[model samples]
Target chain A: MAPMSDSSAATTLLPPGSLPLDELIACPQCDALFHARMPGRGQRTSCARCHTVLIAPRTNAYLRVIALALTIVILMVAAMFFPFLAVNVQGFTNKASILDTALAFLDGGFMATLAVLVAAFIVLIPLLRAALVIYVLAPLAAGRRPLPGARHMFRLSEDLRPWSMAEIFVIGCAVALVKVSDLARVEFGVAFWMFAALVVVIVFQDGIMCRWTIWKALDDTRNR
Target chain B: MQVDDLESTGRHAEPVTARGAGLVACTRCTRVWPMGETRCARCGSELHSRDWRSLQRVWAWMIVGIVCYIPANIFPMLKTQVLFTHTESTIIEGAIELAQHGSYGIAFVILFASVAIPVGKFVAIGFLAWSVRRPERLHPHHRHRLYEVVEFIGRWSMIDVFVVAILAALVQLNFAASITPGPAAITFALSVIFTMLAAQSFDPRMIWDHDGRGPDNHLTSETP
Candidate 1:
């Protein structure tokens, strides 16, 4: 594929009677086709039929996404090690962090797999995705070409999006807290608030990330 | 890529798709490639105009997910020992216990995420797979929307599993009181993973490529 020009218009020369195939885009959700047009910065192009956001090029979106990703990585690490909650009942008190809970399942049997999965889904996957995002976006944000294997790392990050369960884990923790509130005196720890903030940052990062804009930027710079 | 210029170019009455134009779009990056290209030039991922095996893979994964869901419901999800009073509760029982404690909102969230969403995904994905074979059953727009919802909500089902992990981790006080994950946690996690795979295996493009006047029309007629 030829490098797209800096202008928000198709640059590659079209062959005779070939339908300007280079300028066409198919909606990922409904397969409806549209002539690819870059909306003005801060505007969005959505599929007509399904309303799926097609292209949204925000000013400095890359920098913001990278910043949020870095925050997620920091918060996730802290949440894993720092105490998450403490339960006190009948003069007995015990505190546990996320890592402590996940490892509780490690009894060298079927439960060991659960331990690994809990660690992966809530902590490992989210952290890896954040790191991959930072790795892929940092150079791009600084007006340099993406690092080597940028596309592969970006693809892996997107693939792990659904599997990253840190936000869901926070909601789960809230439910668990309420479930045990009557049984014990539960107090939130430093890590609990950090996790809450981490969830908000993650949501904002995902919202601002326009895949089409990122892919176009990557392709344009790589070809140069 | 100029929006104003594209608006002046006029629009087609019927929706056109990449497959109908003898092209393919990368599922990950949405970059278009000619039908003859086996891999995306930009992303280096395989390109297929239509994955003919999509439905088959969906069915296989969905069946396994359903089988695992059965065991997930029957087995206990959490085991609690409170000063020699042992209690084992399945997923529904846990939710009910929460509701009985007047934590109605949290209970609803748990029940909705753990039960309603998973069952809804199975039904929605099954309908999408069945409808693709006989496309006239439902409108393509609605089917595509259903697919989007299924893909979006599949991850939230992990909330219950995370709650179990957090509870098992936090509620430990030696012989006084403790909570541990039961046999159901792993089966439930597997079910969610399998169903997610089933959802991902489905190609939303198939919703628009109806029978008879389908994707092969342009290729067979060669009328360009």
Candidate 2:
């Protein structure tokens, strides 16, 4: 709390072992560093310089995040096979699912990679992240020890966070569907709603879960 | 001032550091430690000052993104089948179609999300990467802000791909009317994925590596 302002652009010296250096935290955004002190449940700690939320612990966050991750898995699986859309126009009607849409690109060799990449980002990455989240969180939520390789699983999940594009896919579809409405008789399928629900649940999961809290929980439980 | 005198004065108005006093902050938990300390005692994370391969990864991913982006804009994004008559539209054509149909709102959104954002991201990421290598081009703070902007807007670039997914999913009326994702759908998604990866591969901490030679640093700050 020593005048933690962005104007002080230079990082101050940490006196050698005079104060425990391990107790400090650096603002990830502005590089202005601060002392590290975990916020209690229902409290939030933000970077003093950039205001990025450093930690915000919530009660029962683990349980809620786990629940949402499970929902994403179910919704994603259902969204794959279930008809995502059925447009009927002038006596011709066709239904398509997410898998069908992704596979449609697999016409030739070069396109095959495209199809796989699309499918991986929109479907596989999300599903994988959700599964990893569950694997990492469920044991901690149950007041049990961290699962085997929980650290690696957690790291992988964090790394893949940006790669999971399921929510983006659904929002993009909504905008696109609005544009296509005039051209065809478009109808939302079960998978569309499922994807929609999955998005909401995922947002909720992200909101509830605290990265610092979970990591602390995992680390504490590991050596016990 | 002596270290003890400064502490006793309690006006401790110096910059914080991971480099000062032989200290390093944990990237995950933000805990500061002695420079030689390999592990963050609190979070059990390997502590490092800056990722050594950040620029390398950023350049590699940007190359892939640039490569994929060529095909993304060149190919048709969506194919519309109306009454057995097929029509293919690249992203620009689709936006033009939307504008012609008087859905200007959707059209602008499409253009903004598809073209403007992606191009902006490429430029921003390139600028950031360049700034890291050549810090004299722009203010380090401004470069850091640009990096944040790139990271924040990364997901929104997928809007075009999403629209494609939605239309492909919802507009299925057999021969009368149906939309299939064109080859560009996959390419565009890949471009977005690569750019995102590029942004991620960049370590923002490098932005502050200005060595005090940064132009106009003194002009911005008013010493209190």
Candidate 3:
């Protein structure tokens, strides 16, 4: 990396004797730089070196992402209350939900933290991310200035991307259900299907999201 | 090889990094700013051409991850009580038992997500961190790809922990049968979290900083 000297300068925008900084784009994955170009609708710009999608702004993408985010939020809430799985052995039957599983360790002990973490990983983080996306994009989707702190909220959602593991949780449940099927009769509950759909929705939302578009929108409009 | 590939694309003969042009991109919003800028005006996030302390943070979190991983493997992941007998199984033992029961698919998923992925993450993150300093040991392009894979797969290791949680919650029968998370579940979760932090703390930009190979005039004198 070039030596980052001149630490005394506090100006936020200073392009000295070069192309304007706003016209430059760097691939997040491989750090390959490129002169920024707005892709046509239904088109995307990928890093030539590593093929990471750098810019992809589809028409009405923000609105679509908002719709999907709403679905994630609704499904996650329902998945928490409804039974996730039911086990029957010799007429004895019990059903459990995601909330139940998360609180299973909360009766008091070091495990209480684990319970909270489980709830956070599967339920809380995803919910928060969806909520943040909606908050950050709702105004932008409506052709208005972003709500105050939209930039920060968008960044927060991006940072939490890896921590949101609802999809992994669903796969884990599938594996656990199979493992337990041998011991007893196991049945998927309504919440299981909801979680499955939630996974699909989450994946679709993430795939369709174009971070550059959102950032550009946030930049173009000054938050009120 | 990377240069040749970039050239074949006919866009540029080689990659041009933001830092090479005396610019910094916001980690959150991907907005490029001049090198002197300390924060992104668009997103209000701190900007750095490269995080100088990234490798140190990577090693610190990696050590914690490794420490938690030791107990995660040694202790039982789940405990089950049936009738008057109790059985406990660690992660690998549970996978093996599943395999013996002919649930090879679930077993493989468990083994891959729980064992192979985590171990691979530790190794990959370690190598990435180590290779940053000794850049000549591995091709930077390959290292960059490895870094991406490690970041993407680190969270999936939570599969085993989720499996334990779901099984414990679903198998709660009054006296005939019951299952609960063992001591290892929390440790395993911690290991996954720490490893993820380790991966996140790593600055991938360091991989490209070894030489001045951008589209701009190359700097013959190394910064450091």
Q: Go through the candidates in order and give the clash count of each.
A: 2, 7, 0
Error of 2 at B172 (Å): 5.3
Per-residue lDDT value at B106 in model 3: 86
* DockQ for the candidates, in order: 0.49, 0.38, 0.45
lDDT by residue (B1-224, candidate 3, tens digit) is: 44344435433334456776667877677778778899889878887777767778999999999999999999999898999999999999999999999988888999999899989998999888776655667766677778888987888999988888888888989788999888999899999999999999887777766331211213323323
lDDT of 2 at B6: 33
> Candidate 2 residues B5-99, lDDT tens each?
43333223434545644567766656566678888765566776766577788889989998998998899998888786899999899999989
- Interface RMSD of every candidate? 4.4, 5.8, 5.0
Per-residue alpha-carbon lDDT of candidate 2 for residues A117-211, written as tens digits (9 for 90 to 100): 66887889889989999999988888888878888788778777777777777777767667867766677888889888888887777777778
lDDT of 3 at B100: 98
Which pairs, if any, clash in model 2?
A11-B15, A11-B16, A12-B15, A12-B16, A172-B162, A172-B163, A173-B162
For model 3 chain A, where is the 10-residue window of minimal lDDT? Answer: A1-10
lDDT of 3 by residue, A1-224 (tens): 11122112111122334666666676665455677677765666666665566776667888899999999999999887888889999999999888987787776389899999989989999999999999999988788888888889998999899999999988888888898887889988899999999999998899889898888778778734
Model 3 collision count: 0
Question: lDDT at B211 for candidate 1?
Answer: 22
> How does each model score on lDDT?
0.80, 0.71, 0.80
